[model samples]
Structures are given as C-alpha cells and as structure tokens.
Target: MQQHKVLLLAIASVLLAMVTIQSGASIAKQLFPVIGPEGTTALRVGFSALMLWLVFRPWRHLPKGRNWRAVIVYGLCLGGMNLLFYLAIARIPLGIGVALEFTGPLAVALFSSRRRLDLLWVALALGGILLLLPDMRSVDALDPIGVLFALAAGACWAGYILFGQRAGNLASGGTTVALGMTVAACFLVPIGVFNAGSALLSFEVIPLAIAVAALSSALPYSLEMVALKNLSAQSFSVLMSLEPAIAALAGFILLSELLTFTQWLAILLVMAASLGSTLSTQKKPAAAS
Candidate 1:
C-alpha cells in the first residue's frame, strides 16, 4: 500500500513538473522578441544556475578528483540540450519541437534494453515522428532547420541522461545538478550576451527571466528528483512521455498555437509506444530466471 501511494505521488509530481516546464516554455516564447532565443536560453540557464547555487550551496560539495570529468560532461550536455531546444522552438511550434526532442530519450531507452518487444515500441515511435515530418510539397511545413535543431537537442538530452547517471554516482543529486547547471551557464552566457547585447540586462525583462528560470529549471528539477525517489525508471519514463502532449496543450492555451489533427495523433502514438515499452520492460526483467 505504501508503494502504491508513493507511485501515485510520483505520477503527480512528474505531471506537475511537466506542466511547470511547458508553461515556463510558453512564457519564455513571449520573451523571444526582446532577447531572442539564444538570449532567452542564456537568461534561463544563468538564472537557474544562480538559484541552484543559492539553494544547494554547491561550493560546499564541489566535485573532487576524477569526479570533475563526469560533472563537466553532464554540464556540457545540459548546456547543449537547453541551447539547442531554445533554438528549435524559436522557429518551430513548441509542441512539435518537444515531440522531436523526445526522440533522444526514447532512443536511449530503446537501446538500453535488450527486450525484443522493445523493437515494436521503437517502430511506433519512429512512425509517429515520421508523421510529423515536413511534407515535401507543403509550403506550411515546419522549418527544416528548426526540425534539425530539435533533433540535435534530443541527442544532447541522451547525453545528458548518460552523463547525469555518472555524475549521480559522484555526489548528491542536488549538488550534481547545481554544479552541472553552473557549468552550462558558463557555456551559454557568452552566446546570450553576444546575441542580445545590452538588451538582456533590461530591468523590464529581469522578472520574466527569473520566472522562466524558476518554472523551467529549478522547480521542475526539484520535483523530478523527488519523483525519482519513489518511481522506477520505467515508470518515470512513461510519465515523462506525456510531456509532448502537455506542451502542445500549453502552447495552445498560452501561446495561441494550435496543432493539426494529424500532429495530435502523432503525439498520441508516441505516448502509447513509450507507455507500452515501459510496461513491457516491467513485466519481463532481464534476470527473470
């Protein structure tokens, strides 16, 4: 019964985290005109790093010895993921961008498990993504560059997951995340500064930037850590698979962006495949013998 309760709480936490993140992303989109996507990425990363430092006091638990390598790689992945995602969304709709970015984690999950049934899930996910691809003759298709950027972000996300696992072994989750974010800020701040120039420092945008940081990074990250404590990775992945849909809804409600029926179906197919993959893995552990 206790396990059941924890699982329920984990589901709620991850759902809430997804909402917060997508909502934050919608809010960030509004700031694009003022700071551009690169600038927004910088503000979000910079503010998140600052907030994480204040909260976690990472200085007290700095990476030592060989541990620095994992932390560095983790941070670089985090930086690349955020920067590329922002760039993708700047040109593409938020929902589609998220759906595309998800391919990375889905790929990681598919490759990590040896279950034969996992291939079906991969096929389904790939089919769904293919459905979202720009039609060769349609002038209204999404920007090709944007799609490529989101795919790159997805790749970075896979790296972030792998590197994060290594970094998790070296320090507390919070400390690892805080330090990783700091390093990410180091990588992005210069690009933001160069792109946005003095505009990034505008007093009017500070509060908006802070809010984005809280919603997109600090709050969601904390919630995910808590959720992870009670949920198996399979369950967590299944729950997280709901994010693209949530992002689509958020985009519609907050940004007036609407997805076509086909796009919505594509998102559903991906979600179904992800959930199926998790359920299949749970039912058939590799060491069942």
Candidate 2:
C-alpha cells in the first residue's frame, strides 16, 4: 500500500508539472517577441529564482558537501534546460520542437535498456519524429535553431535527471530545489541583461513576468522534486513521454498551432511505443547498464 501511495503521489505531481509547463509554453510565446528567446529564458529563470528565494529561504537551509556539488550541477541543468526549450518553442511549432527534445530522455531509456521491447519503442518514437518533421511542417524558418535548442534542453534535462538523483538522495528535495533555483537565477541575470538590454526590468512587465516565473519554473520544479522522491526514475521517464501530446494539445488550444492527421497519428504511435516499453519494464528498468 505504501508503494501504491508513492506511485499515486508521483503521478499526481508530474501531471501537475505538465499542466503548469503547458501554460508556461504559451506565456513564453507572449514574452518571446519582446525579449527574444534567450532573453525570455533569462527572465523566467531570473524571476523564478527570486520567487524561490523568498519562499524557501535557501540561505537558512545551507546544505554542505556532495549535495552542494549536486546542487550546482542541478542549477546549471535547470537553467540551461528551460533556456533551450523556450528557444526551441520560439522558432518551431511546440509539437515538433517537443518531439525532438524527446530524444534526450529516449537516449537515457535506451542506455539503461536491454529489453527487445525497448528497441521497438525507440523505432516508434523515431517514426513519430519523422512524421512530425517531413519538410518540418510544424517548424518555422528558425525551427532548426529551435531543434538545436531543444536538443540542448534535452541534454540539460538528462543531466538534471542524473545529478538530481544524487541531490534527492542527499538532502531534502524541496531545499535542494530551492537552492538550485537560486543558483540558476544568479547565472541567468547577466545573460538576460545582455540580451534584453534592461527592457526586462520594467515595472509594467513585472506582474506578467512573475506569473510566468511562478507557473513555469517555480511551481513545476518544486513539484517535480516531490515526485522524484516518490517515484523511480524509470517510472517518471515513462510518464514524461506523454509531454508531446500534452504540448500539442496546449499549442492548439493556446497558440492555435495545428498539425495534420498523420502527425497526430504519429504522436499516438510514439506514445504507444513509450507506454509499451515502460509497461514491459514496469516492475523493473531495462537494466542493460
């Protein structure tokens, strides 16, 4: 029953993060024209850090040792991940960009996998990406740049998974996240200032920026940390494959971006593949490594 409870908690937490992120993607579009992709990334991270500091008071927690190093890595990964993701979304349809970004976690799954079924999942996912791309209907002129950024985000996300595991094992999950967010914020300021040229500092944009920070960075990261505590990495990975579908839906509703029927079917196939692979290894990870 304890295991069941934990599983439930993890699912709820992850779904909440997904919903928040979907909203965040739209908010980002609003800011992208104002600050450009990199600048918007900086703003989101900057204000998210500020909000976390006020809420969590990391200075008071002051964890020491290996956790600190893990925190540092977590911070870098966190900042870099969102920056790249937003940069991707700015240029491409959210669906395709998200599909490409799926590569990172897919790599992680394959690396840890030995099952024959996992191979099938990878193929399905690839086929899905191809369907989404095919002359890159879902992408814009800058979409390739977005793809590259999404890959960067995926890399960062993978790193976040790796280092975050260490951090979660070592300290209070919430405290670790709070501190990591603060560090990410510190790193983003100079980049944001460079790109946005003080325009981001305006009082008028404060409320909007704050809302973005809250919905996108602060709330999602905190909940994810909780979810990690109750969920295995593999379980979380399986759940995450649904993100493209979520993003597609959100893009359609929020941004009015639409895809062809074939593309939607492709997404379903990938999702099925992911679900199959995950379920096959439900009680156990693929275990190749």
Candidate 3:
C-alpha cells in the first residue's frame, strides 16, 4: 500500500509537471510577436538558470576535468533543444512541434530495449509521426522548415537525455541540472540579445518570462526529480507518455490552437506507443548516471 501510494504521488507529480510545462509553452507563444522565438527561448532559459542557481547554488563547487565535459555537453544539448523547439513552434502549431520533439525519448526507449515487441512500438510511433505530414499538395500543410527544426530539436533532446544521464552520475542531481541550465543560458543569451536587440529587455516581457521560467523549468524539474527518485525509470517514462497529449490539450485551450481529427488520432497513436514501450519492458531502477 505504501509503495502504491508513492507511485500514485509520483504519477501525479509528473502529470502536474506536464500541465505546467505545456501551459508555459502556450503562454510563451503569445510573446513571439514582441521578442521572436529566439528571444523567448533566451528569456525562458536565462531566467530559469537564474532562478535555479539562486535556489540550488550549484556554483559552490564546480565540476572539474572530465566531469566538466559531461556538464558542458548536457548544457549545450539543453540550449540547442530549447532553441530549436521554440523555432519550430514559431512556424508550426504547438501540438505538432511537441509530438515531433517527443520522438527523441521514444527513439531512446526503442533503441535501449531489446525485445521483439519493441518493433511494434517503434512502427506505431513512426506511423503516428508520418500522419502529421499530410500531402504536400494540401494548402494547410505543415511548414517544411518548422518540421526540420522540430526534428533537430528531437535530436538535441536525445543528446540531452544521454548527457544528462552522464552528468547525473558525476554530481548532485539538482546541482547538475542547475549548472547545466546556467551554461545553456550562456549560449543563448548572446543570440537573444542580437536578435531581439533592446526589445529583449522590455519591462512588459519580464513578468511573462519569469512566469514561464517558474512553470516550465523550475517547478517541473523539481517535481520530476522527486518523481524519479521514487519511481522506476520505466514507470517514469511511461507516465511521461502523457506529455504530448497534455501539450495538445494545452495548445487547444490556452492558445486556441485546434487539430484535425486525424492529427488527434496521430497523437493518440504516439501516446500509445510511448506507454507500451515503457510498460512492456522490464522496469529498471531509475538511472542516476
């Protein structure tokens, strides 16, 4: 009973994290006209780094030598992932971008697990992503550039997962994440300033950016850390299958973005594949490395 309750709590934390993260993304979309995606990403990541540093103070003991390599790669991946994702959403709808980005973790799970059943899950996930690409002849087709950006984001996400695992092995989990985020801000802050110019410093933009950092970065990361500590990695990943769906719903409700029935079905298929892949595989203790 105690274990079951812990699992339930972990599930709830993951679910709440998904909601807040996606809601923050939807809200960030509203800022595009003023600061552009690059600027928004900078604000989100920059502020997140600041807030996390204040909370965790990872600077107290910096990683040295080989450990620094892991942290740098982890930080770079986070920076690239955010930059590409925001760019993708600038051209495409939020839900589609999220679905595409989700392919990273799904691919990781498929590649990591060696089971005959995993093939089916892989196929289902591929088919769902393919469904998002309607005929090029269609007037309402997704932007090719946007799709490319999302795909790139997915690649960075895969790197983030791998490098993050390494960094987790090297340092305190919370400290690792906080320092990685700081490095991410270092990479993005310059680009943001150049692209948005002085507009990046607009007083009106500050409040929304702060809110986004709290919702999308700080709170979600903290909750996921707690959840991961208690749940098996398989359980954690399976629970996260709900993210694309939650993002879709958030886009619809908060941004007034709607998807076709077919698009909705595609999202469902991917969600199913994500759930199946994690659940069918034997549970593994959450990797701290």
TM-score of 2: 0.83
TM-score of each: 0.94, 0.83, 0.94
Over 1-289, each residue of candidate 3 has an lDDT whose tens digit, in order, gives 9998988898889999999999999989999999999999999999999888888898787898888999999999999999999999888888888998988878887899777889999999899889986568988888988988988999999999999999989878889989899889998999998899898889999999999889999999889988998987777887788888899999999988889888888888889898998877654433422
lDDT of 2: 0.77
Q: In every candidate, how many clashes are there?
A: 0, 1, 1
Best by lDDT: 1
Q: Model 2: which ten-residue window has the lowest total lDDT?
A: 134-143
For candidate 1, write residues 216-239 as lDDT tens digits.
999999899889999888778778
RMSD of each: 1.7, 3.7, 2.9
Where model 1 places Cα greater than 4 Å from the true spot, the runs are 1-8, 286-289
Give the range where candidate 1 is weakest over 10 consecutive residues by summed lDDT: 280-289
**What is the per-residue lDDT of model 2 for residues 197-258, given as tens digits with 9 covering 90 to 100?**
87787786566778888888788887888888888867887777788888888889889988
Residue pairs in collision within model 1: none
The alpha-carbon lDDT assigned to residue 129 of candidate 2 equals 65
The C-alpha stretches of model 3 lying farther than 4 A from their native spots are: 1-7, 283-289
